[model samples]
Target: MRLPTLASTVERRLLVNYRVDPPAISRLLPAALRPQLVAGYAVAGICLIRLGNVRPTWAPKAVGLRSENAAHRIAVEWDGPDGIQTGVYIPRRDTGSRLNTWAGGRIFPGEHHIADFQVHETGKELHVSYTTRDDATRVEIAATVDDDLHDSRLFSNLEQVSAFFRRGSAGYSATKTGHHLDGMRLDTRRWQVTACQAQRATSTFFENPDRFPPGAATFDCALLMRDIPARWHSLPAMPVETDVSGSVPSDARM
Candidate 1:
């Protein structure tokens, strides 16, 4: 049985986002999910987060877990009971915590890979780098946080972009078991963001020729968030509608 909700303290969360070719983004998503478009392109990015005091809401913070984590996510939409739902589809997640890596998907909504991480923060500058132990995935970034949104192209302005993600509280991730996607919702008391300049960034998954041709994905923008309080709740399995256009399997597993 899934817990009602899990509470955690967000020590730090930095999102380094990119605007990729919609078709390219679509290729990466399961058939049950379609890319959530912005100005005709797909949105994808990496999230570097540190969570503290993580445990069931009914539990005490003193017994909570602290961990460093990252996720490769794509903005996506899928069929929903009310209508189409907007959220993120996470293809991969990595963490430095042993428990999360071991019991993910089995006891949690998503499965995690054990990875090493290097992080640094100074004033408004955020730098983070990580790679899976198997070396199959890599993400690195050095960005300077700012309040400018005039340079953004995906959204008309920063507020629009912030609101977009604020509403996308739901996320689907690969489960440890087979191809099943476990749903999870991040409930936060507030939604906030600050634009950033990507001094340098790289994503091997999007760079893979097997996945995307050159120019399919280009770095668009970055966002930063500091300390926040949040809760995570387990959701039911997604209702994916299958189609014949190079779609994912009817019984889609992570």
Candidate 2:
């Protein structure tokens, strides 16, 4: 779905990150992309975001839509015209809004699976979960705001972690066609993240033994952002080699 520049309010966004063995990560990415490592481990994660007032740049706030969404992503680097470029490669996207599901890959930049979402947020605590229509993907996370990142093996402080993700604003998503990847860039007016302690977190994709193996991926930390204005801009699709299709799951056919 082609669209003009989109604007939205990031009501809440939670990033649950993991550090995975590079070998495991490589097997999942397409040939055009490779894992972008940090502190030697490949970074992968889930982004659970709730968007408000999502509409075309010129649309009024009242005409906007609100939706709960999630993306299973891996930090990756690829050779671009400029040089080596960094971004996150999204293998799958799920959304609670039927409009989003229908528009995905047509109006939106990526294909989205329809899912039922459950989100409960309080002053300092949060619980988010979702199950896709086909039941192939499920995620559950319970967390609370924290003052700092204390146990992350990937970074020492919050500033370091925030900067790391900020650079990865560009994202490419897998499409069913398998010929090319849809691209999008998230430009936020203010970039801010808070340290969060994940009391419990689980992702079917990251935890799948067939994909990540038992010791291949480990939970690192979580970050939270709220009430930030952001824009989503579409980019030219990146072509993919025919042989790369077999590397991703059948549902995503990257």
Candidate 3:
């Protein structure tokens, strides 16, 4: 009897669902503090908040700057049923100065999925872009911030945030989890992925400490599989629950 030889196989992909764009470098810093804060973008659902700031150890006063100042803040909220997502920008010269506050809730109607967001600097302008999917509807948005602004701190921070979503929780209530990444700390309950497709989609909750000073700021992002037996209407009509104690969800079991 003759035996046949077997071939070995290698899997090239990792199990992680997140993908990060290469960190972009810039010389847009003051001469003395140039080595401290390195500017870059991180992608999450619908584009997470971008950031540009000096390192924690570098005191703003060392460069004749104040820590209590913000150049501007741009906020975008989606309302699923109304078929519109609204964005607002507030410019602040001093930290004590307050921008117009926005309440948290659904900002747009019929929004099913949101992703592919980026914020970049072009000369003196700041640009932001994102894609929204509402049921059978699809739309893309690109906006720019072009005003003579000497505040690099606010611009640096805004340039660091980006987001992407796999599934649509159109009416789900988001919980907060207390966590921090880089200088940004998230203080809220954590969200768990319930019914994700091909392990590409997962749910996460984050709170941006820099933007929401005293109160906690929170948002959600996830990756979704392209095609499967699942339809937008096949999912449950209930909101996914959050684990305040960091317990894993039962639905996450494969």
Query: By TM-score, who's the top model here?
Result: 2
Clashes of 2: 2
Give RMSD (Å) of candidate 3 vs. truth: 23.8
Superposed on all Cα atoms, the candidates' RMSDs to the truth, in angstroms, are 2.7, 1.8, 23.8
Question: Candidate 3 — what's its lDDT?
Answer: 0.21
The residue-by-residue lDDT of candidate 2 on 144-201, one tens digit each, is 9999997999999999999999999999999987778999999987999999999999
Q: Which stretches of candidate 1 lie over 4 Å from their true place?
A: 176-178, 239-254
Ranking according to lDDT, highest score first: 2, 1, 3
Ranking by TM-score: 2, 1, 3
Candidate 3 global TM-score: 0.17
Question: Candidate 1 clashing pairs?
Answer: 179-253, 179-254, 180-253, 180-254
Give candidate 2's whole-model lDDT: 0.91
lDDT of 1 by residue, 1-254 (tens): 57468899888888777888887777667777899888988998888999999998999999999999998889899877799999998888999888998877666688888888999888788888888897978888998978676566788877888898887889898654434577899999877787888889897877878777888888888888777899998888664444555345422332
